[model samples]
Target: MSIKRPRTGGAWSWHQDYGYWYQNGCLYPDMASAFIAIDPNTKANGCMQVLRGSHKMGRIEHGRFGDQTGADPERVEPAARVMDLVYVELEPGDTLFFHSNTLHCSDQNTSESPRWSLLCCYNTKHNNPYKESHHPFYEPLEKLPDSAIKEMGSKLFEAKTDFWDPANDETVGTGKDQ
Candidate 1:
């Protein structure tokens, strides 16, 4: 889940989900993510930007971009030059699914409305990591009904749950938790 506050959101450097997951020991590119728009996604609001068909290029080396781990510009620059750069504009409730290797990023929101989204990431059993880190190994998925969302809508995340904060993280650059 991500929340880009109106006019104050920060930019996300170009990156691939697999770039991060690979560090977690995932052996294959059998992963993906579903991005659901909770608020309107527009150009002015910093909608998601994707390099079309870039997933076919396979995984690229990743390194530090400010406090975040991002795709190395050496690769991203060339790919962006030849590929179609698509701005993913979506209305509320719209969902966009993409492969883990797809290069993507977003700019800071300059609109008055907030840009919020729910990101659901998935990993296949065949590509389970060799070692455990912050992410879990393969486990049986508990199917839930659509009504589950409304049922848990009012619930809040527990404060003690050790949420991952990239800004304070010291190991994302090294691909291991310290």
Candidate 2:
């Protein structure tokens, strides 16, 4: 499941882990995505929250702006943490849609539940992994449709995609197709 912020805010924001694709004006993903919950999420437990329209910020220099909640003190604006953030709560099967740049975070698990959530992102074949390290995870791009691509500046990413198998206990990285 996804998270959402209160209704009072600007249009959008941006980040590294997540961000608004300026190539595409809309924040809602052009590609398809899914949220999976291993356990229920609640306000008492750690739940996902999002800042509406926070993606439009266009990649803020997190350290230049000044943010302290970062897990890495030295790496300012590390990944998605560089963008604005909002906390979201969720229940099993309660899915929410967010734009690419939407700033979001998972709250602490105040409840007994594990609050597990699987965030799967997809794009067109034309779209490639933002980071070189992510290359091995995706299939090759060949005549990928526009609907399948999420535009980020000159870069492109697969939009219409699905995980062959998530690396969970049963699907451990044995190097075989899940």
Candidate 3:
């Protein structure tokens, strides 16, 4: 999950999460992510922007942009010129399910209110990584009822969460060899 704080939030360059994931050893691009809005998401607050149906274009070349990996602008620029741009504005509690290869980006937040969101990523069992990487290998997920969330309450946040240390991460910078 990630949060985009208002006024100080930075922009995400146009890129697909799978563009980098493919280099992480995933053989196929069969993955998805759920973006759950924790706060109102609006263009003024840097709501996600997507090129409609760009996933059909498949993964484009990705290269470094500072500490971030972004899609090649040479290819993205042509697509942006012909594709319809969609501003994914959402109300709190609204959820957006997107394919991993979907080309998406966001502008810097210029609103007074924050744009907080949680992104739950999922990978298909058949698309398991050939080797371990920054993401997890395929494992059967336990089914939980909707009420489980409310029942857990504050206890959920108390659980020890394993966070990725970028300094130790081999997924970025090293390219496919990682």
80-146: candidate 1 lDDT, tens digit per residue: 9999999999999999999999999998888999999999999888887897677766778799999
Q: What is the C-alpha lDDT of each candidate?
A: 0.87, 0.43, 0.84
Highest lDDT: give the candidate number.
Answer: 1
TM-score of each: 0.81, 0.45, 0.82
lDDT of 2 by residue, 1-178 (tens): 2332232112111233333232222233444445565556555555565545554553432221222211222333453455444555556666666555444555434354455567766665555445333123337647866765555346756877454433432212232211
Q: Is candidate 2 or candidate 3 better by lDDT?
A: 3
What is the per-residue lDDT of model 3 for residues 1-178, given as tens digits with 9 covering 90 to 100?
Answer: 5576667756788899898788888888899989999999998888999999899998898988665688989989999999999999999999999999999988887888988889888888999889768777877879999998898886635545578776776544532211
Q: Please give the lDDT score for candidate 2.
A: 0.43
CA lDDT, candidate 2, residue 58: 38
lDDT of 1: 0.87
Query: If the candidates were sorted by their lDDT against the true structure, best first, what order would they fall in?
Result: 1, 3, 2
In model 1, the clashing pairs are none
Number of the candidate with higher lDDT, 1 or 3: 1
